[model samples]
Target: MLAPERKANDDFVYHSGLKFALLPAYYLPVWFQAIKGDSAVESGIHILPFILALVVATVLTGVLISCIGYYTPFLILGICLAAVGSGLLTTLGVKTSAGKWVGYQLLYGFGLGACFQTPNMAAQTVLPRNEVSIGASLMLFGQTLFGAILVSIDQNVLDGQLANRLAGIADITPQQIENAGVTGILAMIPSEYHEAALEAYNASLRVCFQVAVVVACLALLGGLGMEWRSVKETHTPDDESATEEGREGGEKDGKVDDGKEEV
Candidate 1:
């Protein structure tokens, strides 16, 4: 809904949804492959903790929203947890334990999942029945746009970090590094500098996670802007038909207020 009172809440939920949707998709697996020395398949597998946690949290949040009627608390809680989780993830390094990574992923995933659906839910709640679909779709479009733009920015950050760190290390040239790719950069470096190269790669990946932390914090701020509102199962076919009639009548009368026909 574009009503003045609902604008802030709508904007907050939509932007926050962007952070929850994008972070893990861009950062976690790269961290696994580069820092943890995992193969593509293995890296994907290792992130199961996060994926599974997200799935569970998504389902649970939907159930809770249905039961509780209010989703504001969940949005606030999710962003806070995500920010904390991202902060913890930023501390990861080459020597970070498997347990720590898994735990951190779980935390981040659950946080993301808990509020990922809130934007659409809130949009549906505030929008008129006829406008709900359009409102929800617009929110999703913003989320997708954020994902595309942020991931590209993240890739540039990581690539720049690697190029700077890998310079002047052993006999490896930038050409060879670029030709071989990110994962291959370590192998191209001399064995003596492996530790340094590993640390560099870790540093780069850490930067990616750090971006997630910053985004999550911003998302939290957005979440905090959301209005407190309850969702209720009050819509019925009769109400929808009446609303449609109201719109038609409004159009005929050349007078409408908030989608209701003026008589």
Candidate 2:
């Protein structure tokens, strides 16, 4: 039989927690490079807002959960915010303002960090001492699996969209664009077709962002059904049994005292 900690409800926690962990990883740098015209180093630097926001949010979430002893509320709020943030990111265009992109990234990154570790929290808190590792492993496995799958899917979507858009450009084929590499795409294609190619690439990236939004929504739905249990430390079964024995002994002594008084 499945252990108590390995039940269907735990699956819900894992599923919801896995969605946003790597959602931004797939497209954030790509968007910066393809649309924003940043070099590899510049692209990485441009995504700093999201990374920093995630770091702050993660630390805050850990502290809040430690203090409040409940992770469900954070999980719910985080997933909802992530969904909304991702949806907002879909509005990004070739000429979008820097402020808008930064703000959107902060929102999405914070949301992702707030609940990304919730499944692990659930595992550690809900499982027995010996089973905690098992619970944690389950959550980790789900998270890693989702990360690989979603990122690959995003890449495929980007490639497919680019292929369709560059079909009749006459200057270059989608294969060359893909193989020419991210930085060399413009060099491989004719100069006259560069603007159109860029626009198509931007549109494809938007589609990738849309996928993240959908995943976040699905995670939000899963989070809604999670049980709102506390993560506070509690007594072990052995401690509870010893306390029960002490109470019984006290009751017996009281009964004997009453019998003696009646005599």
Candidate 3:
């Protein structure tokens, strides 16, 4: 049985696709990364957690990246925790890790889910009270803009791949096309059609796939830059001020403070 945490993370990642049906093109692979364990397995079924995590991670990610504004720090921290969860799993050995990976995945998602919006919230908190509306506008704008850019990039990459694949098998038979899924579709073509189809498909799709890989690589780069600040780490004056103001006023006050000052 999967841990509650794993279930949560998987769901979270999957929900990210609510933005669109095809969004999986980008996020589905995140799941695979965890199971690959640096490609530890030669072949066959890797951990099922990857798929679940992919669903949860992507879903929460959309919320975090799109909805949350200034809370980027907290989100960063949450990701760290998630990594720890995965790390703990890895450390646990295969069976144990497999079992615990769920906790790691869920806690990571739940912990971060609350914080997904923290960045924007933080940004708004940090800004002057009068600037709150402006801050929000900007935050939402950035999210929408990035969404547009990435969506376009994703479509182009996919279109190129499809076009190439179709062209490669210019003489593609009904049988070959029927068997095609994503990866296996091309491989299934009969030997007679394989060469031309591969040439055309590979030629066309390679660039798009390459670009898709590049974009994925860039996303990974963002993860590389993540360094979660621990509780012991000193916060900026803005965060301190936000806290002080929150204490003075209370929870609502904290929200007010977050809106008026920095978090």
Candidate 4:
């Protein structure tokens, strides 16, 4: 739905729909894991760290994307840590081990808030000021491509695992399993398959995390491409200006970049 409007619209309805659809999958698992682990805030004071991280990430991305030559190791570091932490949070949430819920939520939440807006911001900054609408559409086209792919891949992997697990249990028909509630499925499962069913679910979830990590890793690696492009754009403009000025400076007998043009 979002792919066609690469030129004129940028509402990102498809992208936003994809985001919200996956939010429940991401949020509930983390929320439950946190609650299960009994990690309560000692006080409201503990929430400040997440807030700070979120603010810093937004500010840093704004600087790096909106301002030229703002490249530094900190941007790379923040992106890596935040992406990996977000991946692990998905794993931890669904796996449901006893751990600090609030702490984990803050870690993952801040990581998400920090990086989620960066790409759109980059797309926005890349556009000329006059083409805001077209630029927005382009941004959403890109966003939709990635977002749709992510949700599709995750859903496919999960659903495939569920189906495969059901198939292995000869006693339970596919229709039977589908018809059954979580309770009914558990109750109807042959004892021999119970452990395997459980394992399949956990494995499916782990696979989902693996897929998400791969996405983040791809983006992280792709940052280099953005960096190269930025540097090239910055230098190209400077070079063009310098050449024009030097030509106007009467060529100085091939004295290029010798500040003769500066005066």
Candidate number achieving the greatest TM-score relative to the actual structure: 1
Off by over 4 Å in 3: 1-73, 78-115, 171-263
Instruction: List model 3 lDDT by residue over 1-263, tens digit each.
Output: 12322322322332222122223333323223322223324211333444455556546665554443333454545445443433333232222344464554454344334334443444344444444566566556655665576667755554455554664456545455435544454455576865555445434333433443333323323433322322223344445666677677765444463456436
lDDT of model 2, residue 151:
74
Name the runs in model 2 displaced over 4 angstroms: 1-17, 171-174, 235-263
lDDT for 130 (candidate 4): 41
Put the candidates in TM-score order, highest first.
1, 2, 4, 3
- If candidate 2 were superposed on the true structure by all CA atoms, what would the RMSD be? 6.8
Name the top lDDT candidate: 1
- Cα error, residue 182 of model 3, in Å, equals 8.4
List model 4 lDDT by residue over 158-261, tens digit each: 56766677677655665665476333555676778766666655555566666655555555544433322342243333345556776876665544566453
lDDT of 2 by residue, 27-138 (tens): 8788888778898899999889888988999999999999998998988787777777778888888889999989988998888789877767766665556566776777
Ranking by lDDT: 1, 2, 4, 3
- Return the TM-score for each candidate structure: 0.83, 0.82, 0.37, 0.55
Error of 3 at 138 (Å): 1.1
- List the global CA lDDT of all models: 0.75, 0.74, 0.42, 0.49
Runs with alpha carbons beyond 4 Å of true place in candidate 1:
1-9, 12-17, 170-178, 233-263
lDDT winner, 3 or 4:
4
Clash totals in order: 0, 0, 33, 1
